[model samples]
Target: MVLHVVIASVAALAGRSVPSMALPKKRERAAPVVSAASSAMQMQPAPINPDWIIAGEPVARMADHSKSADRAAYTALWDCTAGTFRWFFAWDETVHILEGEVHVTAEDGSVHMLRTGDVAYFKAGTWATWRVDTYVRKVAFLRRPFPAPIAFAYRLKNKLLPAKTPTL
Candidate 1:
């Protein structure tokens, strides 16, 4: 239905009439399917020393940063193996696990087991412990917290002066 509408619209815009079939002269190219692991591998993540460690041995990390916008938004591919540690998030993070298994314990002691194809979110100021049983590879999207006064001002400005959309 959408294709038909698009064909009709294109014909109208070109000042041409559409045939009953309205078949295209050329075939569309097929896009290749890319696996998450394959794409992460393409990232060429670099090994780095763990910044913080709480218990057991320190885990090894390989990370590739895809983007960092004003230190506000960050996107990365991270891989870690064999360690357990506590974290206090200063930023909000959303992670999609691509490989391995992990057990995450919240501040209140609720445990969440995550494995391949699982996703989790950690809010700013939230405390959690992560136990990587074997290994874990994930894509993370993080948003750092803004200063309270700046955040309040930005919110007030947006509320008072909403954006205007121009008419065509």
Candidate 2:
């Protein structure tokens, strides 16, 4: 009778009616995946989750969901008919042609024509311009927010070259 009374009192005070769990919360389950966009949400440099989003051709910006890393990536839209204006961006990137055909011009004026299934890698500080003679797409993966002063210096060096540009 004494043990029963104590147990009942303890259960009532604890409000559990049963033993509590002592599992580790550090071993929690991973969070679910959430997409950055749809037809509804547009960004204004808005708060991003930093997962990733590449809607193929029309949208040019990459979306982030994590809000933690310097990793950036995007897929490019290529239109051979547009014959896009010559411009160069400073960064290393991986390019894989998804469809149609296009020409890429390196800083030295060298031109490489790519078709569906072709691939190319642009080194850090590699100067390039795109000439899409056909409508196509390319996937690009790039990393920024360098770690140290040396890394930043290197990225700056590649992006800002001396004016005596080379002729290919």
Q: Give the top-scoring candidate (TM-score).
A: 1
> What are the models' TM-scores?
0.59, 0.43
**Cα lDDT tens digits for candidate 2, 10-47:** 54654553367786656645345544332233322221
| lDDT to native, each model | 0.69, 0.50
lDDT score for residue 101 of model 2? 73
Candidate with top lDDT is 1
Query: Candidate 2 at 101: error in angstroms?
Result: 1.3
Global lDDT for candidate 1? 0.69
Question: Tens digits of per-residue lDDT for model 1 on 53-128?
Answer: 5556645554545444234777677777778877777789998998998899998889999899999999898988
